[model samples]
Target: MRAKAFDTKVFKRILEYTKPYQWRFNGVIVFAVSLSVFAALRPYLLKQTVDGYLKTHDAKGLLFYVTIMGIVLLMEVFSQFYFVFWANWLGQDIVKDIRIKLFKHMLSFRMKYYDNAPVGQLVTRSVSDIEAIAKIFSQGLFMITSDLMKMGVVMIFMFYMNWKLTWIVIVAMPVLVFITRIFQRKMQLAFEEVRTQIANMNTFVQERVTGMKIVQLFNREAIEADKFSQINDKHNKAWIKTILYNSIFFPIADIISSLTLGIVVLYGGIKILNGDHFTTFGDLFSYTMFIGMLFNPLRQIADKFNEMQMGMIAANRVFDILDTKDQIQDTGIIEAPIFEGNIQFKRVHFSYIENEEIIKGINLEVKAGQTIAIVGATGAGKSTIINLLNRFYEISSGTICIDGKNINEYSLSSIRKQIAVVLQDVFLFADTILNNITLNNPNISREEVILAAKKIGVHEFIMSLPNGYDYNVKERGVMLSSGQRQLIAFLRAYVSNPSILILDEATSSIDTHSEELIQRATEKITMGRTSIVIAHRLATIVNANKIVVMDKGLIVEEGSHFELLNIEGGFYKNLYYSQFLVENNS
Candidate 1:
């Protein structure tokens, strides 16, 4: 378990986000102070009206006092309205800016960081943790500060009026402070446990729901429900602990408050009855009200103290993510408006994990407009090569170059803009076909997208839909068939007008007819562009200008397809024959 202690760095960072809206937050603080002063005045005014005006039966004097009290009440109401409005407004605006900054920082992280992080935990940080910080500004910081100020003012006035009775009230103060400190520590631990349990529950539920189809198909619904119940029970218990602490603390505070009020009433009444010169009926009445005002805000301050602890815990969690140094630092200064598509790999080596190289000392070259097909069994680092080419992962040794310059010398966005990829598992956003293809690229007009679709032979298929190019492809493009999704992916890449193209097992999952259409489309698109194809179906890459066969982490053979077939007992020849046998048998 992590410590529940307050972190100064996290607290200071959260405060820094409020710097942009300091003027508004300062205005809220001014109103809060005014509210405290006005609230303290109300009780004093009531005591004066009851003891002075009522006993003398002076109607005009009473009217004057009542009118003054009414004006104070109105001023208090106005102050409270502005305080609440501005406090909440400041909190929400600060959170909005923080949320946007957090999201943008997340976007810049390397893929390796996400591969190790949980989706549910990240969601909890971005949404719920930020909300907790908002409460600090609105309910925790200003509210508690105002309560403390009110207590201080009330104490000063009580001492000035009658030091003897004030001393009686002061006896309860030590007990209240001691009890509040203990309650705060326990509640902080309880709140931290609650946050952890909620995050665990969210992770479990998100994973189970996403894989519900598999669970139901396997008839594990009852078993999964039992598991969920156990997690939910832990979540329930965490919250109950917080409630138990709250239940114990507030009643104790109330009891101490009642005791203080009783002592003041008993002591002050006796002084008045004994005819003490300094003691008056009105003074005693005002002391009663004063004691209540002091204790009430103390009780509120205790509650707000709990909220502050929870907010600090949330800030620590959010800052942990912000502090992560696992980011791809883009230092490349070169910009490429167009790449000639000359690619070369010289002794490139890499590992997704330390000391377990997946690509080792591989050398390859392709001319500006050549198509090279890579044929290999799984785990031969075929896809890893493409990953390095796009700079999704850095190479551990040697160099990869495009157009005779190191790929890293060019800015990441510029390099990626001139290269496009269509993977076997196509992913599409839930959006209109037109928007999905254009991807809201301001420079790529609708006419260009339509032209690309026609050139790729997918225009007729798109127009045949009910809404033509405007048809919506629902989440993950689940509304469309696998083949239709692939077509859309192709069109999306086509409209980008990339100088280099990569097709990773592109026709591996489609039916024969769909495969045929894609094959023709593939030939047309790869005609004048540099293309790299990772093929499981040997027939798709038979006409490639060069074929490379890899096994383990090294290239075993490299030549034209037919030329590789002539090599005795070659890996490519064996792979091609094995796939051909499966097709014929099927």
Candidate 2:
């Protein structure tokens, strides 16, 4: 839903983007004004040719006037071209800047913000909504300005030709104005509905398309199609409402214009019949043309006004994102070229929601370069610990520190630079394996990436592909198998050479062979760094220096693997025996 009135603040903010390209826009405005003047002069020239040359039988004068009119027509053509070209240029440049800023702003937002905001809505704001704002500059605002100026000049000339006829034309203005007001109001509602429908449609289509495999696999295709049909039906209705309003409004405007034209013709004919010599035929002809010119712009003004209104509505939405304060505040000023990776969690507690603490009053400390493995059941806050360490979500209470300094004392980028996480679900961009590993980091060159991959034992596997390291993973790495993507994720993390490495169930879903390779790669990468392994499989983390077992948001057991296995009925020992029995049976 949109507000009924135009938001001045949003409009003003949109106009501020135009300031950078104001000179180019000024050129466009110059052309627009010239075009308007040229249009007004056309009818005036016709009046002169009709009365001054034709009535007087001056052939030479007629030829000169016609030649001048032809030149004016040529000027109009150039003016029109440059006007459109420069206006579009200005608008495009402004929106380009806007899209870049908006996207960068989106990147800065915290995970919590995205948890609630839909991807499709963000895309609409950045793409379609920005385009709407561009229309305001290129087509709506400037075009309306030119049209109003033309109408003004035409009105002045109409009064000059015949005051009585001008009054008759003026009388029709009220009716046109009334109709335009009604049309604009109705169209505003229609356009708002259309925008909402488009956002909803985008959300539906994006999500469904991304998850189309589930739809087809579950044999819910028909059901989903019906759902889509319902959404599309609403989208259809929204646009149809717009068309219906336009259909009613434009014809009424046309009728009013035609009636005014008729009145001018009738009144002029009667004046001529009454032998009024001053009311010449040429004057009446130009007056009729002027009335047409005036009403034409008046009608167009309504459409342009709607465009501006829509743009304003779009501006409001975009500004809402730009003005969002729900971002990870990078207020920490500490700079770290390298972190020793000494980490501590003291009385730390957190929740994704209020009064539903997932991690409660946990205390742990790890020496630099030590490997610690945390084993837990699902929803036991194993991954939550990693999230908190990364500051992906701020802890609700207590402190988490790195290298004896509060984690918040270092800039997020500075801290993240020294930490790398290989998640269970590996995400790879549609890019060559080399770039995927290096993430296009100039600091980590191709040679460095190859060296890291080779050291981690994935370089040979990567080279086995047709394109070697240059293989394109395609979207979400769908071209690769689950294990291959995991190996790539490992290589990507290894290449970063982070001081702190987090392997969050990295081997959970891979095949046995891939697991062996990953486990070998894991040992090499974690040799001289602080590593935290979140594993469901006890076998994978058997080599970890220390083991912490968590349950129901508290550490139930903590010790070396053998030390914990000796604890009678200990949580870790019981979980280990259970998993061992399962593995043996399988």
Candidate 3:
């Protein structure tokens, strides 16, 4: 099991959710107790009729007796119904709130959070763990309440009627609590094991299915099957342990209950025989019935122990996510909404981790609406430039300013809203192409979408599809070709007309034909934007107003196409000459 650090403050946090429903919650408890009282009264009424009125056979008495019992039964039924309906309503409502908060917080965390965390575990936290909180609060908590309230009240009534019989039952309370406490501790560990196994199975399923292409490519289907089978086998054994604990809990508790029943009747029977109380058979019979009712609640209380334990484990997992602070956030004290594209990097330095720095004392200035292209080998810190501009990761030293204001001083939404990014890895929603094109811009018209697509040369192609804008992208647009997906993403980014545009390997996956078509579109998109293009193919970026060559996180060269070509000795000249020869030979 993963080590869990329980926040003692979970109850305090949970209380905030229930605070709005205090009256309704109090009503639920009142109904539960009322039902218990009614149950206790039922058996007592029979004792009165048999001991007092039945022997006389009075005509009016019989009618009164039956009518009184019917009313008590009706009240009990309604009380039980009220408790079930609204408690479940509250549980599900809390689940909704929890899911929303979890997602909101998860989205706010720094990009490094997702880069390190497992996607499978995050999915479990959102779906299964949230459900666990709901299940426990609904059926498990309410049922427990019903049993405990019923048992407590019935015991009080039993003691009032017959102290001798109540004490006999009381003698068994210590043994029951002891047995329950022992099983509860052991069962808690078992429940945690079950939760761990479920998470493992989920991770196994997600990894195998998401990487089906890799598995097939490597011919590792048998290996994946064995791994999945092992997880399932562990899950089975953990579940069986839960079952065995549950199975033994009831029976062991029942034996203690049965033993109490024997002792009560034997001691009470001896007393009646000795003329200690009353000799009538009806009195003894009702007494025994009352004791049986009390035992029902006790056994139920024991059984629900395991449920509460499982709920705690689930709650801990969920709270873990809530406890993490989003490294990026907006403190709404004040915010600026409008921005221009002017950017300055003043001795900027950063690292994804503490061990090694990627950018060292890098300083540059770019006028608004200038088109700059960055070229470098892989891992030469080309993409880090864009990441810093977007404030996805904070700078470790020095400052970045946009429009002469520190970027960190601006609202997160304000800064990001003005920036558009088209990454090498393209993604689209599983919704209609129109909605995905417009994204969350509700006020955008279809005409605007069409214009944007046409400018990017994807409009005619989109119309050729069967459903056009109404078609589902099918979970990350897997149904669409890579080049096609890249084009749509580019179109979407341009439609926003953001102040700062970052294109990271945006055209690397497209074919020669698609590349030719998109180049015209790219010129239209970058016409008046502060566009930064990170490209591998030198031919695609020759027209950029400025080209910067990077090596080992420093800007090694910066110039126009002619100036860099004339040097013939720097890194850029070597790269250009090599690619230049390949192009001429072809």
Candidate 4:
């Protein structure tokens, strides 16, 4: 099923994340209100300065008035700096917390979710979508709340000065709101479109850059450029839509504002002639200037509404990730999960997608400290079986157990901590050679890392490097060859010394020389552990304590190599004779 968007309930839940920072949030509210009051004070000062001092021709009074107004303005600007600064800081922190939750939840999802989903889309949602929410959390929040407060105070003071003129200004407000909202809706739609296009663009770039060598080899540059052009056009159109709508709204707002000022001049001129209450040259003049300053905050308040709406859309996407509850929940509380290196699958059935089984109702049992080899053709579900055994995907039915305890009964972390996997395509971190071996287990010493490396036959090579154990592998260990990279993967798993081990075609990439070294390492490493090897190389399975030959999701034969070879024309016998005759002869 496609993911669902958030409701108002989700927004409330998201706000609850801020509960821990209530004190900081309260400070922001107080600072924002104070800043707003200080901002509106300048207009009041001008009115008082003009009516009380300038018209009455008191030079020292005007001087004192100017000085106070200057101080207030300076203080307002200063408070604004902190107000914006703290809001931004809080926004970044909130995004970080939300992103962490998203990441953790993503990991909890079943492997099928990742297989079907796009990597670029997930990254953009986690990073950029969350950042969009943060932008509103920061500047947009302070500006909107502060300006709205200023609007309220300005209205009250205007009424106090002149009630009749207040109605004139108030009458034009509905027109401004109407004009403002029309663009606000348009801007929100435009930004939403832009967000979608940006995600698509990210997906395109991700696919292209990650497969750049493939693109060059296949001469697919023209197709990639064409795809990018389409996304770019969509982004351009969304941007133009925003500009076109804003152009209509802001100018109309300005015109309506000018109309209000015109009304003030018209009605107030008559009032002044007739000595109307609160009407004079200085009062009217100062009110007119204040009215002029009102235009920006009004437009900005509308813009903030538009911004918040877009952020809310992005926030909904973020919450979708957080709200997902995968079936693969690990509730086990084992402090030290010590297993006997025995793994059994009892009538296990698994399907990556609904109604299509890749592994169907299979039974297998392994003793502690036994090496089992899984042999199968491609698409025969060998890797899927391994993945399910490791709890990467929950089975459709049946039980996987270690030492007779259901796999689900153990905490995922503890279960995973007891297993180490080295796949055909090995992955390495962008770090020192030593750190790649140890990963997150920080207590590991340099000597221990070297010990694992030596066991895997890469210690001599690493020692020859310029920096030895400290030598950086760069991103994904790109500087290393396939065999060297495979050696590092071996070292990592060896260092973990997990009770259960998985080597999924890990030796498939190595040459004859490297394979010999790897085979020697495997014998040492798999000692005293339940080792499961998925391989096409029949020679490797000759030494396995048990060999299971699978085809079309069922184990057709199982036994030790000699025992299987003695079977009359069975699948394992035929596979061994055809694939490993040379190795057998040698």
Candidate 5:
């Protein structure tokens, strides 16, 4: 993508974040002007000491001027200290605000957004890109402003001292400005490439590390390493391009600055030798200092401008996420703190992709406190049904209702609050088991969790762990076995005391003993609450009040386990017999 020369829109949006810290921003401007004035006054003082005092053979006058210059230096030093401190402080404050906003926006987005976004890319946006934006305040925009003001004041002093010598310095400026302009454009593009490559590397590393077990099990370590090396090389080359441009620009700039100083000295010396009244030794001395002051800020401006450009680019990317319309709109006004556990899907049609329905006109119902079991082959829209019920994805057409009210009419949080789901693959945070079970909900106390665990008959199992309920599960609960994690998930769901409970293949991958515990826990949890159990194991759902067999996205059979088994040609009958035969043979 071609980078914009400057993104004023993005820059303005970033500045909007500074409204809370407007006083600090205004203070930065005040300090910039003060420092510029100080810079100009020092050179003028030096000129006065040289010509006005020393030429008159007045020691007291010279000492007075030197003392005044020393005081100005001290004031300038203090201003600079506060300037640096406040500018950095302002940047960090702004960064903290933007990071919070970005994360909160991501939290509001529907699962559809995360379905396509890489986790590592989001990490880069939140951490690395936001850090680049901080430099805009600490080192980029305000710094450039201060340097420009200093250069301007210094030029005014140079011309006032001796306009003849000032012309020599101005003569070489157009060439330097032209070089800086070229450097800025190239650097912007280079930095853009650098940001993209950094995101790519982050995404690659995050995925590989998260799935390292798969890499080793498949014996693809060499292949994955080669891919990573290629990504690393691209990242290196992108950075080298920026470094190469810096390497070329600074030396040429130094040469121009040195040549300008030499020209002023040569031309002024000739004028002095000719006894021209306009050229004085003091004026020449001040002009040389002025040239150094002038050219140095010009060079530094190039560096600071590069930083501002990077901040603008990073801001643009962050705003893209903030501007996304992928959030599931929470327009429902009705607040139902409790659901009666009645659910109905009326001609519900849905799709993850356009014109490709995943749930084709699904119509089903479960009465209050009924245990309904949905069984189907893989990709038969079984899990999609659960996702739809939880409002993880919006339906394309038709309506879902809980307790005779359209699900969309109920507040999103209220709807989710009443339902708890335990999936086939359980996920637990890297925290103590108690915290994972309660999810840090302040209302679910430790005593209540222990009570729920005891009721579910897993209290003894948890007590056997290193720290009982306080055991740290580690990342994704990898410290525990799969069965152990599932039990924790069961307890997590149980403690919530949700009005509706969903177990989506929760027993598919556990040991027989763990399955028995889950079955008993499931029986207890489903006693008074409506439960929907989606199972691949035929035996597990035999006791469900209603057994619904789905084929593709349509329900092909519905009955009690015995009633379905009595139908010889029925889908559930064949499925149950097949599973039964497999168990008998094994």
Candidate 6:
């Protein structure tokens, strides 16, 4: 979409952030006004020294006016300093608040939002776009206001000294303004394209870096590099458009400004030479200074206008995310610190997309402290069940309950705090093992993590590493083996001491030894908690209190492992035997 050159709604929304810093914002305005008044006074002082003191050869009077001019200059310097400092200070503070607010809002979004959103695009919105918004305050809004005020003050002094020459100078203004209007619209469009290309490049680079292993493994480096080169070129071209506009617009403005100065000098010098009483030499001198004062801000105004335009464009983008209503509602009042772990899904139906159900009317129950295993092939909605129970997604039409109370009645955080999940694809931040397990939660002590690790029988394995619990697992735990990462994930879940535990194919990818360790840890942890295990490996769930067989989003069989095995040609029986035959052959 083509961006508007000025968005009033967006500008007003940005102004709202200034509420907390009202005093500093007011200070910026005060300094701006003072600077403008002082700037206008300088030329007037020089006119008086020239006409009153110099023409009469009054040396003492010249020294006196020069000293007064020096004081006004100092005051002007002071005002300019605070104006810049406070404006930038206010901008940084507002952007810091916006970044924090945006991040916190993202944290509350449903999993569905993230499923389709690009990670790099979100990063751009949070980092780069917000930085653009800062320029609104620092270089855009306040600077434009100050420059406009200076222009106004200079114009008034020019008109007061000689209205005839002032009219000549004003003649060139309409042409400059016309050119600026056209430049403003064109530059806005160009900047919008620049921002879009920047986002595209960021997304490409972020994905490539994150999946660098796959890129190299599949010998796709040259291919990916060529793709990145294309994206980078687009970004470069977008930026060049803005640069091209600047080049064309600024020189045109300067030429118009220079031509206006020539006209003022020609007209004013002729009026003084003709011995007109209405115009004097001092008037000519001050009018020239006035032209510079007026036309300089006039030119800089266009540049600042571009800054404001880009900031508004960025604000519009940033506000789009802030205004999203897809966040999971945390309106439930119930706060159950500990759940009884009696989970039930009553006629639950869900779909990530409208009218495309993934879990079709699933009705299931697991009594307190029971171990239930769900087995199915890929796309069978097995993982969807765990997601629904955890409320990472809201069911389309259904009721889920824990301890006979509807899950919706519980506060989201309270309910989530009572359940822990360890997924097949484990994720660990780059941090010490202890921090990763505790997730830097202050309440979770180092002693507690160590104690939980020892209980799970992975303490020795951890200690065998470079620094035991202190060893840093690099980004996504790339420093550790897949099996070791799973072990760390188990320890993380175990340390939470959740009432309801879930393992979503946690052992499907690990080697025999790590699987053994995880299996033993799993048995120990599931002793008193209600557990749901979704596994492709049927062997792991043979001892489960109940086994569920699923296909095409429906429960095809439900019973203990032996009971399902005894059924002739049953779905569970066929699935179990197929896995069994594959294992024996391998």
Q: What is the C-alpha lDDT profile of model 4 across 1-586, one tens digit per residue?
A: 3222224665576677778788888888888888877877888888888889988899999999999999999999988888888888888888888888888888788776787778888988988899988876685666788788878877777777777777888887877877776667667677778788888888888888878989999999998889889889988998888888878887888888888898898888898899766586765776786676566688777778777767777888788767766647777766455679878889989887789888889899989999999998888888988898778888999999888888888888888888899999988899988888899587788878877777667788788787988889998888888877787788889998799899999888688877877887788789889999999888776889999888888887899989998999888888777876766677
Output the lDDT of residue 563, model 4: 91
TM-score, model 6 to reference: 0.98
Report clash pairs, candidate 2.
Answer: none
lDDT, candidate 5, 313-371, per-residue tens: 98888999999989887889998878899999999999999998888998899999999
Quote each prediction's TM-score.
Answer: 0.96, 0.98, 0.93, 0.94, 0.98, 0.98
Misplaced by over 4 Å in model 5 are: none
User: Looking at candidate 1, what is the lDDT of residue 269?
Assistant: 79
Stretches of candidate 4 exceeding 4 Å from the true structure:
1-10, 270-278, 334-336, 580-586
Candidate 6 lDDT, 301-327, residue by residue in tens: 888888888888888989999999887
Q: Report lDDT (Cα) of residue 350, candidate 4.
A: 84
lDDT of candidate 2 over 80-107, digit per residue (tens)? 9998888888888988999999999998
lDDT per model vs. reference: 0.87, 0.90, 0.79, 0.82, 0.92, 0.92
Count backbone overlaps in model 4.
0
lDDT of 1 by residue, 477-543 (tens): 8778888888888888888889999999899899877787788789888889999999988988999
Model 6's alpha-carbon lDDT is 0.92
User: Clashing pairs in model 1?
Assistant: none
lDDT of 1 at 69: 88
Query: How many backbone clashes does every candidate have?
Result: 0, 0, 0, 0, 0, 0
